[model samples]
Target chain A: MTTLSVRNLRTHFFTKEGVAKAVDGVDFDVAPGEILGLVGESGSGKTVTGFSILGLIDPPGRIVEGSSIRFNGEELTAARPERLRAIRGSEIAMIFQDPMMTLNPVLRVDTQMIETVQAHLKVSEADARDRARKALVQVGIPSPDERLRAYPHQFSGGMRQRVAIAIALLHKPKLIVADEPTTALDVTIQGQILFEVQRLCRESGTAMIWVTHDLAVVAGLADRIAVMYAGRIVETGRTADVIERPMHPYTKGLIGSVPSQNTRGHKLAQIPGMTPSLLRLPRGCAFKARCPIAIDQCNEMPALEEHRPGHWARCWRATG
Target chain B: MIVYIIRRLMQAALVMVVMSVLVFAGIYLIGDPVLMMISPDASELEREAVRKALHLDLPMWQQYLLFVNDALHGNFGKSFLAGQPAMGLIFERFPATLELAFASLVLSLAIGLPLGVYAGLRPHTAGSKTIMTGSILGFSLPNFWVGLMLIMVFAVLLPDLVPGWPRLPASGRGATVDVLGVKLSFLTGDGLLHLLLPAVTLSLYKGALIVRLARATAREVLPMDYVKFARAKGLSERRIVGVHVLKNIMIPIATVSGLEFGQTVAFAVVTETIFSWPGVGKLLIDSILLLDRPVVVAYLVIIVFFFVALNLVVDLLYSVLDPRVRLESRAT
Candidate 1:
């Protein structure tokens, strides 16, 4: 069974100026034990998609009508708040970008973890602590016993992220929406965390949506990749196909701009334009102004089409 | 911690010495107590005798030296008018003022914290708007005017309007029960009733201060990533607000509350006078009018002591609320 299936999801922010469609008609799915990398630049709504899955959108922003988010065949967009909260951190979990910001500074690690356990399960304090200790060990944290008594600030940057990962893995959730969990970390630490996360997901058979802007990061870790632009997924396919045989012009430009893709001592390829503001999008294709292969016919909005097996692109020229 | 406290105590001793010097020199400039004490019909010889007896004839430096020596020996001289030891007089009234200050502090925390949290959490709600507006009124109104208005409403007007309402006495501690050799008015029902009006009047401004502080801090902390993380952990709304939001906001609240408590204790003068409460603040004002040097000096010195002690308590509380502070201090 699919761990998550999102179809026609439109999350909009109703500001005084205009309705900003942050996530516009997005569709994707993750099978059990699969890793889907939701790759996008800033303002592309990758994080918003993650938050919507958890029903964490606050006032002035909402998952509009006609959107569907099904986790294990259960519709989440229409679920009650209590039901959504129950599913969160137990059936589904989330990990944020900044580890330093995620854990409560005033609370000790054990206090935070124990309460997290008690929030869903009716377990004794000692039992909860025992589980927390085990979770910490599973994430490869040294001195798990003493570390539980320390505050968030006491740990180094890498260690803090390990704690956050441990907390997310405590409930053995079936799905995790990690939003750039290692972006703020150093390169070595990022690799270590990626390795740990991949190992844990494989061991637990947990499906995960890894949201990031780094193509290089997902190239190695993600089984499939979904490249997003202007709040919509422009192209998606298996990681090897998306990287080596990119169909959409936007995805080609993204893969070309990576520093490792070009010959040594050569000027790196660059995408020409900034992301369009979501409040007032252009009339037809959002990437028309920036697309190098634009023609007179590019004025019309293109629909996502499968040009190859299990590979989709949102461009008219993909078939040609 | 012990070293820190010992250092703080040494600094406190220095501050008290400097404060005593300033108070001594300042009081000397205000006019001779001998001039204000004796009758107008008294002869020059009587004035000279009074000056010598009170040591007013000595140089200011010499007088201060004598005062310091007596203070070192736990004798802060005697009140010129009352002919009683100044420390004894102040100590007798200290409990009443402290009780009033503490009562108002408790009242403020009990009322202000919840309202502030509510206002911060749902800042756009109508009830929060009303609470914020009331806090603004609490801040802007003068203490004496608020005290008078409260007296007029609860003590004077309400009793006249409602036949069954008891006529609240406008002044004095009604009756006191001695607990551990300190007279407390809150023990008996009538005494508590007598305390109610003055306590409310005293608490309003401080309560408003705490509300603004707590609201601002809570608003700042509510948007922190830790708070959102708490929600993502499947925590109930109440647990998120109570544990995460409250704990983070308490740092600033504790600091402001401690300083404000010290201020109320030192300067509840207008409230004490309006209600005719025989507390240290009233005694201070009376001593100033009578130019009772020893009593005024003793009062100010004690206030300084309270401030230093309260600051220490606040720092200690900071360690408890924030572990970073605790660990760093331990490291040092």
Candidate 2:
């Protein structure tokens, strides 16, 4: 069953110059326990899409009216602040790229984790601390009771991210949005955290949307992948299928640019040209200017359509 | 923590020693008190007698030694004006300035913090805009001008403009009231009435200062990744700001307020003089003008001591408020 559904999401920023369509007409669905990797380059609106899901966009930037984000059949986009607060953190959690950013520098680990538990639940402090300890243990911390006494800076980068993951899992949230939670860690630590997170999601049956620009991380961990460009999803499908048979030219270019995919002593293939500024996106397909297989019909924007069963791409040339 | 305090105390003692010498030498070199104190018609014999009595005839180093030795023995010498002990006279007027400074500080914080938070939350709103504009006047308007402006509107004109409007006093510390059988000045209604003008004047510029500090700090804090993380955690707006942002902004606010508190007392000279308020500030100015060296030196030493105490308190508060500082300091 679908755990979260976002339809026609449009988040724009009203700037001094003009409106910047940061995330324009985005749509996706996540089933129970499913991990959907929302992959994109910088400024592709992937992070905006994540923030829009949580109704966390501040003004000057706003989720334009008519964007529908439904979680467990509740209309979250239009939910009252009280109701939104009820669902947030308790049912839906977000893991940030920097763990220190997630943890308040002035507070102890236990205080924050305990507060997260009590924010929605009517649990006593002891019960909250118990659950916090359990969450910490679940995230692979040793002696969480002692660790909880330490501050955020007391923990190493890897340990800090673990504590952050623990906080996200404190309530066994229905949907967890991780925005590159381990991008700053070394490769080995990143691998460890990714594995632990994947295991937790699998065991808990919690749906997740992992927002990242690193396709390599998503390739090993995600159940499905959605490729975004200029603020819209250009392609999406089962992870293995999309990796092996990328129908969208942009997806093909991304997969080709991976260093390991190239032979030794040979230059790695790179997508040509810079990512077009979202403020001045092309009239047609945003990638048309850089598209190797562009045709006259490409002058018209192509809607995201199913090229095969359960396989989608937003391109006129996406024929199986 | 004990070690830190001990170190601080030792440093403060050294600073006090250096400050005393500088103030003593600086004051003596600038002007001669005998010239101001003695009548112009006095004989050379009388002048020599006066100089000998005050030890002005002694060598500079001998004078310093005498000053330090007498100071250590709790004798700061007589006030050249009233012939009362300098310390005793200064202490008598101290509570008035302290009461004024504390009242204004409280008034500014109570008003500034909330207004600043509101401005930060809705930065583009008309109210915040007006506040921003008003605060500029707060920053740029001289304290004396504000005092005069407030007096013109509230003291001089308001009573005539509105019936039953009690005319606020233009100057003086007002009549004392009996509190618990003691004649307390600030506890009285008339005293508060007189305090209104000076307190409001002092609070206005400081309140503006706090507003700008809070507004800037709030703006910087709101965009931090932790704030986004907090929002995502589904914390209420109040909790996000109160629990997270306010504490962070407090670091800078506390530091600035500490400095300002010391400044309010130090610079209260002009405000006190304008109003004829019998505070240490007014006393300092009178002493300086009269070349009352002992009174002036004692007043400065008291101010320097207050400053060091305030700085230490602010540093300790930083550790309490920010765990990062605590850990870093401990590590060092």
Scoring model 1 with DockQ, what do you get?
A: 0.82
Number of the top-ranking candidate, with DockQ as the measure: 1
Q: Please, what are the lDDT tens digits per residue for candidate 2 over residues A241-261?
A: 899899999999998888783
Interface RMSD of each: 0.7, 1.1
Could you report the DockQ of all the candidates, in the order they appear? 0.82, 0.74
lDDT of all predictions: 0.91, 0.88
lDDT of 2 by residue, B1-332 (tens): 87877777787778889988888888888877888898999999998998999999998889889989999998998987688999988888887898788788888999888888889878999999999999998879998898888788888788889888988897988987755543445688888888888888888888998999999989998899888877777777788899788988888889888988889988798788777778889888889889898898888878888888898888889888887775335522
Q: Compare the candidates by lDDT and give the number of the best one.
A: 1
In terms of TM-score, the best-performing candidate is: 1
The TM-score obtained for chain B by all candidates, in the order given, is: 0.97, 0.94
